[model samples]
Target chain A: MADPIDFWFDFSSPYGYMMAERIDTLAAKHGREVKWRPFLLGAVFKHTGGQPLPSQPMKGPYSKHDLARSARFLGLPFTMPEAFPVSTHQACRVFYWLESRNPRLAHEFAIGVFHAYFVDGRDISQMDVLEGVAGKLDIAPEAVAGATADDAVKAHLREVCEVAIASGVFGSPFVVIDGEPFWGVDRLPQIERWLEQGGF
Target chain B: MADPIDFWFDFSSPYGYMMAERIDTLAAKHGREVKWRPFLLGAVFKHTGGQPLPSQPMKGPYSKHDLARSARFLGLPFTMPEAFPVSTHQACRVFYWLESRNPRLAHEFAIGVFHAYFVDGRDISQMDVLEGVAGKLDIAPEAVAGATADDAVKAHLREVCEVAIASGVFGSPFVVIDGEPFWGVDRLPQIERWLEQGGF
Candidate 1:
């Protein structure tokens, strides 16, 4: 079997959430699996001098409209959270902690967190919210709580961000198939073609 | 006939060049026409605090790669010009000057300018290059030279930039279909859908 696609994203990115909703199915169509790597986009932004889309002047407003339009286009439900672009370290920590144990469960938990934040308007930045998401997946709440504060887990997340930056991942919804990097959910069609044509 | 799709772009933008190559064909498929509006992205960046893609840190390098990949994907010939993101006022002015008298010829001139700058790596900011491109289209070289320095044409380009900013045109390759704004060359698929469905 070919290597799994590296799907890098931030829990706070709406585009990431949108990609998360469909990446697996898209990958599966090509007999490929996806490695969901939830990293802190803020850390990557530090290296790139990039700001969140909703905060940039003209881009900010356009992004909001685009996000909604894109969601509708994709037939996904999305509501911009009031507490948007919140610190995603907490959610990232829980994701890594779960991923270390059960990769599948971790993917499910990531989806839950994205749905909570984007569709349900629930802030996934809070520990209780993350623990609630974990609880739904039958993950122990105490373990999730412990993982959120674990130094090793925090370091691991940081290391992931560093690796992403080193790999030239400056934005969320970044995908690395084999060695080729594709950024943005908008590149999905291109990604599909790349997978089918094997690097066209 | 339906209203023309307002296609706004910068002469220096690679993505804009890519979009310019296909937008007419795509719009014509839906029995629509495209209004080629060449404006100064630099002026919009002033209000948007945006920088050129190749100037940003990580995004810069990634943009270079993505541009090449996207060009190849679209089956279009593209070479990164040595003098990229150059002052586009001369090209814009000449375009508008020609557009004022003849829009079809102006569009043909715009494509020639894009081909010269992007494919041939010519520095289009120079007056000689503009005249050369105009000369090919059977346009009088002296008239092209006169348009390059025309005060009214300069004011017209400035007004175009102002109008672009006021319409929330923060980036090049932005399209407006019946008041719906779509940004990026990546948005072409979505634009196609909107044109087909008349807004989804």
Candidate 2:
């Protein structure tokens, strides 16, 4: 089997959430495994002078509209959270925590977090919210709390984010296949083409 | 016949150059005409707080790579000019001048300008270059020079740009079909889908 494609995204990104929904199935069809890695886009933005799409002047409103439009276009459920572009640091930590123990469970946990924000339009910022999501995933709220505070898990997430930065990941829905980088969910067609043509 | 699709782009935008090659055929396929409106992105950016893609910190480098990759992926000729992101004010003025008289001639003129900057890597900022491009189309160099200097032509472009901004065109290759706006070349699939399904 070919190596898994590195699919990196921040939990707060709408496009990231959309890509998360489709990437696994798309990769499976191409005989490629996807390593779902959630990282903090906030940290990455610090060095890159990047701001959330909605915070930027004109790009903000257009991006918000595009997000909802793109979701509908893709036939996916989408509802903007009341508080958008929230901090995903804690969510990232929990993802790494769950991922360290069980990759499959982590994937489900990530989906739960995505659903909590994107589908239900619920805020996933507070610990209780994350705990509720983890609880739904069969992960005990106490376990999620305990794992979130673990020094090793925190350090592991920081390390992964650092690596993602060094690897030129500046945006959500960033995909790297065999050292080739593709940013944005729109690159899915190009990704499919790359897999089909074995590099164009 | 339905209203023509509003295809707005700046000559300096790489993605805009790519879209110029495909939008016509795409629109024609659906029995729709395209209103190729070239506006000054820099002027629009002033109101929108948008900088060129290569000016943004991290996104700059990635955009440069993707521009070339996108051209190759689309099987189109692409050569980055030595002086990129050059001022397209004069070129735009010429476009409006030619467009006012003959929209067809203006379309061909726009293609010549795009090819000169993107394929031939020529410095199009010079008046001589503009005259040369016009000469190839059998448009008199003197007439080209006279049209570019026309005060009405200059104001016409400014008016067009203001209209574009009012219509919520925040980026290059922005397409508005039946009152729906789609941004970026990546949204081509969605655009096609929208036209086919009459809105999803």
Candidate 3:
């Protein structure tokens, strides 16, 4: 019908995690193809004249309450993984690998990272945690880790991060289809329906 | 057992309309009393370093897409009202009157305004349109026009707008309970759960 849908995501976001869990099913229901693109969330924010959401001092109780209620309503758990605001380089690299090998696995990897944080309350920014999530997904844990230093993959992740910025991607868990961008996990179904309409 | 909740809101929001549609029911489910507070959303945004969600520019497509999905999910007929933005002074005063007089009707009036704009595509920013909305509610067509300029009510409206700024309320459809603020309509349930748990 139209071009495929691109989902730009990062490992350090709870809303991204929540959207990853449901987007695939919704996409399939609408007979649309989804491409998962993982990038560094922090860098994108820095480039886009925005700051890390948690960086806002006035937004503590308000953010927590909004997210907690959202989690309950969406039937997802809520927790700020101890390693939140953690480094996302390795995760983004692994995501790049998954995108090349199997996009479905990339989706699973994103979900694993989300569960590792909000559900298990683990330090996902840690190397061991990333390895564990990769292992569970049957990806070559060592190979994924080894590839982190590869100039090619590193450069690839770098390009995607830049591309995410240029695309007007203000936040993570972003969906772009037909030149339209939808942000927030709550907007997942809307993307799917738009995909279903195929440019109506 | 904590203090009763102070519910902050501006009438010119669809999400607030959605929240008002069910907030009281949710409150009753939790046996919590809501102290309805009327505030100016324009002022809240001005003081909070925030912009109307659509004004963010980056949030354009996301806003349209998300609202479409939310409408479908909620099974409510919604349209992006032609009048993108409107001031909430008159609406807020009527709300203040209803807040002090008949809360149930106040809620109806709020929902009516939101529905008029979001569902029927009416320009609520226009006084005549507001008059129509008020007349439809049997609120005395003049009440709508009269409240905006009434010295006492306008002053009260100003007081609440100032309070909203002081509280760091930067968004419309803002929900605050017991001095704790929840921004966005999505957080309504958490307020309910908090109240249910003997919370403020």
Candidate 4:
């Protein structure tokens, strides 16, 4: 079997949420597996001189429109959260903790967090909200709460972000297949083509 | 007849060159005409806080790879020019001047300029180089030189860039169709779908 495609994303990125919704299915179609790894975009942005899309000038409004348009184009449910572009470190920490135990359940937790923030318009920065999402997945709320604040989990995510940065991952929904990095959800078609043709 | 598709581009942008090579044909397939307007991205960058893709951190290398990949994907010949991201004011001025009398030849001149820069890896910042490109299109080298430096032509390009900015074009290869804006060469598929469905 080939190496699993590494799907890197920041929980705070709307585009990341969108990609998370479909990457697994797309990878499965090509008989490939995907590894979902969430990291902090804030740390990457600092080193890259990058700003969130919604924080840029003309790009701010266009991105808002495009996000909705893209979701519609992909036939996915989407709604901008009241508190958008939130700090996602808490959720990231929980995700890493869960992933260490059950990778499949961890993916479900990711979906729950994305749905809560993007579909339900809930603020995901709150630890309670993240714990609630974890509870829904049968991972005890206390277990999630405790794990999120654990030094090991926090350090794990920090190391992941550092590794991603060193690998030239400067954006969310960045996919690395056999070391070739493809960034942005818009590059999905190209990624599909790449997988189909085996690097064309 | 429907309004023509407005294609806004910068001469220095590699992606813009890639789009310039195909937009006319794409528009023709949709029974739509295209208005090619070459403007300075520098002005828009100032307002949008955008640096050239090649000047940004991780984006720089990714953009170079994407540019070549996109060209290959589109079946177009491409090469990175040694003197890339050149000041294109002179070429843009000549474009407007030639467009006034003959739009068809102006487009031909545009093709020549893109070919000289991207395909041949030539420096297009110099007046003599632009003159050479124009001369190949039957435009006199002396006349091309004279028009590029003409006060009226200079003002026209300045106004064009302003109009592009006012229209919310913050990037190269920005396409506007029926009041809807699409940025980036990667958006060609979306643009085609938009044209086919008459707006999504």
Best by lDDT: 1
Model 1 Cα lDDT, one tens digit per residue, B16-50? 99999999999999999999999999999888788
Q: Score the docking of each candidate (DockQ).
A: 0.85, 0.72, 0.27, 0.72
Q: Poorest 10 consecutive residues of model 2 chain B by lDDT?
A: B48-57
lDDT of 3 by residue, A46-126 (tens): 664566666664565466666666777677767876566778888788777776778788778877877887889888777
Task: Tell me the tens digit of each residue's lDDT in model 3 across B138-200.
Answer: 888766666777788778888988877777676666666666567766565556666666443
Q: What is the TM-score of chain A, computed separately for every candidate?
A: 0.97, 0.97, 0.89, 0.98
> For residue A94, what is the lDDT in candidate 2?
86
Report the Cα lDDT for residue A185, model 1. Answer: 95
**C-alpha lDDT values of all predictions:** 0.92, 0.89, 0.72, 0.89
CAPRI accuracy category, model 4 = medium
Clashing residue pairs found in predicted model 3: none
Residue A163 shift from truth in candidate 3, angstroms:
4.5
Q: What is the lDDT of residue B134 in candidate 4?
A: 88
Candidate 3 wrong stretches, greater than 4 Å: A1-7, A21-34, A68-78, A98-112, A119-146, A162-169, A175-182, A187-200, B1-7, B22-36, B97-108, B137-146, B162-170, B176-183, B187-200
Query: In model 2, where do residues sit more than 4 Å from their true spots?
Result: none
Regions of model 4 farther than 4 Å from truth: none
lDDT of 2 by residue, B139-177 (tens): 998888888789999888889989988888889999999
Q: What does the lDDT come to for candidate 1? A: 0.92
Q: DockQ: which is higher, 3 or 4?
A: 4
